[model samples]
Target: MSLASHLDELSRKHSDIERQINAAMLHPSIDALEIANLKRRKLALKDEIEKLKSQPTSH
Candidate 1:
C-alpha cells in the first residue's frame, strides 16, 4: 500500500480507538483497569497518528 493509504488507515483506526475510549469513560460499569488499558491504547494510537503525520510525504 502507498504511504497516503497507510496514513489514512491509521487515522481511521485512531478515530475508532478514540470512540471506544469515550464509550468506556461514559460507561459506569466499566472496570477501572479496563478503562486504564483502553486509555493507554488510545494514547498510543494518537502518538502513532502524530508520527505518521510528521513524516514527509512521498508524492
Candidate 2:
C-alpha cells in the first residue's frame, strides 16, 4: 500500500479510538484499566501519525 493510503487508515483508526474512549467515558461503570489501555493505544497511534507526517513523501 502507498504511504498516503497507510496514513489515511491510521487516521481513521485514531478517530475510531477517540470515539471509543468517549463512549467508554460516558458509561456508568467505567473500567479504569480499560480506559488506560485505550489511551495508550491512542497515544501510540498519534505518534505513528506524526512520524508519518514528518517523513518526506516521494512523488
Return the top candidate by TM-score: 2
- Number of backbone-clashing residue pairs for each candidate, in the order shown: 0, 0
Worst 10 residues of 2 by lDDT: 50-59
Q: Give per-model TM-scores.
A: 0.74, 0.90
Candidate No. with top lDDT: 2
Report the C-alpha lDDT of model 1 over 1-59, residue by residue, as the tens digit.
87778878877887887788788889899888987887788788778878878988766
| Native-to-model Cα distance after best TM-score fit, residue 49 in candidate 1, in Å | 1.8
Clashing pairs in 1: none
Q: State how far residue 26 of model 1 sits from its true place (Å).
A: 2.1
Candidate 1 weakest ten by summed lDDT: 37-46
Which regions of candidate 2 fall more than 4 Å away from where they truly are?
none
Candidate 2 residue-wise lDDT, 21-54, digit = tens: 9999999698989999999999999999999999
